[model samples]
Structure formats: structure tokens, C-alpha cells
Target: MNLLNMDAENRVVLNVGGIRHETYKATLKKIPATRLSRLTEALANYDPVLNEYFFDRHPGVFAQVLNYYRTGKLHYPTDVCGPLFEEELEFWGLDANQVEPCCWMTYTQGRGKFGRVSVTRRGAHVTATYGDMPGAHRFEWVNPNS
Candidate 1:
């Protein structure tokens, strides 16, 4: 029997950033051409001490990412920033478009230690700038409604 099609006896365990998760290959194979699917295909090595496949990533965020595959719904974590969560979603080969509009606004226009930002949010439309002043370093216009 192919490992991908393994039954109850073929359960796989994943250890992501010190967090252990038990899942079946079948559940992971739900979405093809993704990191999880590839990991499933590669037949990741099992850790004797942990008894799970080791993956170095954010455990808190991975929980949300895993839910996407399981439920086909992308739910962003409130505790994580939009950019970082988006990066993780990209790594998982998931579309950022699936995220909610409110999630996008979490980092649309903001100031940080590196630079300043000016954001214009008109309803669901968003225009943003990054740097010391508006239109300084980076400029982006996004219309989530469209």
C-alpha cells in the first residue's frame, strides 16, 4: 500500500518547532503541490526520541496553517502580524487572497523602528506608503473590494 494511502496503521506525526502534531498522510495530501504535500511525498525521517517528523517553523502559526488544509478555510491568527503570517502562508503554498480583509489592514500602513508609514483607508480601499514620508520608499494601492 502506498504511504499516501495509508490507513489507521499508517498515521504520521509532525514535530513543528518543538510542537508535536499527529495527522494522517491522507489529510495532508488534500492539498497537492504544497510544502505539507511534498513533505508527505518525501517520506520525512522519523525522530526516534520524539517519534515525529521534525519541521522548523513557528508552532503557533503552524496551527493556523494546518487548519487551512483541514477545513479549506484560511483563518489568520490575531496574535501574529499580517506580513509574517502572509509569509508563512506563501511558504505553505497557500494564496494570500484567501485571507480576510480585516487581516490585510493589520499591516497596511504602519510605522516601525526602521521607518514611518502613512496609510489611506477609504472603506475597503487602501493606499499606503512606507518610509519617512508618504510616497518616500514604497507606495502601494490596494482595493480589497475589487
Candidate 2:
């Protein structure tokens, strides 16, 4: 079994999903995998707040993004997802064909831009807002200087 010491504010683990991934800084881990799953399932099932943040989005994409926060990496960027997956490729409705792909990043995070990727649920499309920009979104794919 994997060991996770979540005995403090920020929990840390030496392995996850048997992947053995490490974190930049070790945290006091407390929540075990089962507890984490229970919490996640409960949050996903009952959190209207999260729904407002990403309501009507694909479950898979939402899960992927959530996984990013957990693992500190985003495996599915627009460029990556575009070439790797076609429309109707993923079980969730996170189609890379809906719009352009985009990527962005902050100081702590590394860069892997993939352009703007958007998807529609019913009649409206998930959009991003930038100050006076035509469409400022999260996945804008800003290339970092080498």
C-alpha cells in the first residue's frame, strides 16, 4: 500500500497510483487514498460551487484538470490533446475540435502551451475573459523562452 502523511495543512506523498511521484516539498500527509477518493467523490457529487466554476463541462476534462492540481502536471493540453485525440475520442465531452487550443502558466509552473481549446455543453460555450482582449482564456498556450 502507498503511504501518504497528511498530518498538516499541505499533505505530501512519496507515491501515488503506484507511480511513485514526488513533490517539490514534502507535506504532512494525512488523507489516505480511500479517504481522498471519498472526499473527491463527495465534492464532485455535491459541490454546487465547483459546478458554478465549471458547470456543464466534460467530466473527464474536469477530472483531468483536478488531477493536474493533484499531480502538478497537465497531460492534456490542446496541442497534445488535438494530435493525440480526435473528436469523440475521450469519454467526456472535452473535444479538442470545438475551438482553438491555448496554454498559459505562472512563475512556479513550467510552460507547455497548447493554444485555446473550448467546448460547448448545451447551447453556450465555455469562454474566458481577459481585460479588453477578444477572448482571454486559460489554455492560451503562451510559449516560454528557452
Candidate 3:
């Protein structure tokens, strides 16, 4: 998600639901310039209208997830970016690697890292969970007409 913030060191804040989800940033460093340039070239041709609000310095990470969301595409080659996701897994480092085909949202309230929140899918929508919370929510891809 695109956000406005003053960045420093290894951190950024995601503004979700009006509250700043102030937390650490997992943005990749040391992006290999050559491969990134190729990805950029391929991306410009695809975006006829330039609508994606890319949050990465280059589109590698965002593009990986967006294509997964947009057209159910996967394994689009992260040759230079393989290290990026590995970096994210560093904190998830000790935690047991849960089976994939799951949804997880992790954030923080203060100094502590909140573990990934559980998620469930219902039809075309997704629901995230916080244990024992009274209310639960899901966001369906909005289609004015189905």
C-alpha cells in the first residue's frame, strides 16, 4: 500500500484505517540495478494508464504481489528479488514455517512484534482474525455489478 511518511534507517509506517500502523519496514536494500531495469521496462509497457501506486523503489515486490492479486499469476521471477522475501522471513526466522495457502497479517502496537494474524477466505472475500475479538471483518473485491 502507498503511504506518506518520513523514512529513516529500517522503518516506515503504514496508514491503515486512519491509525498509523507504526512499525518496522521490510523494504529491500541493495537491489540489483540491471534486473530491476528490465522489470521496469517490462512494467511500463503493461501499464497503459500508469495507475499502480508502487511503494517499492522499483516495482519488484509490489508487482509480485499485485499480479498475484490481479490475474492469479505467480512465480514471475524474482531472481534479484529472491533475497527481498528472504529478508522478510528473517524475523519470521524462528517461528515455525506454517504451510502456505494461508493468509497472515502482522503488525505491532509498541516494541513487541505481533505474530501473524490468522485469516480465512469466504467465497471471493478475505477475513482476518485477532483472537477473542468480538467483531470480524472481510473485504470483498467490489464489483458494482456481478
| Highest lDDT against the true fold, candidate | 1
* Tens-place lDDT digits, model 3, residues 1-146: 23533444335332222333232333321222222222332443233253221222333433443233234333323333334443433322211132123322221111122223577765655666543334433334433343
TM-score of each: 0.61, 0.21, 0.21
**Which whole-number lDDT from 0 to 100 does residue 72 have in model 3?**
36
Model 3 poorest 10 in a row by lDDT: 104-113
Q: What is the lDDT of residue 126 in candidate 3?
A: 60
Candidate 1 — worst ten consecutive residues by lDDT sum?
106-115
Off by over 4 Å in 2: 1-54, 77-146
**Candidate ordering by TM-score (highest first):** 1, 3, 2
- Regions of model 1 farther than 4 Å from truth: 1-7, 40-50, 100-146
Kindly report which residue stretches of model 3 are placed more than 4 angstroms away from their true locations once superposed. 1-54, 87-146
lDDT of 3: 0.33
The residue pairs in collision within model 3 are: none
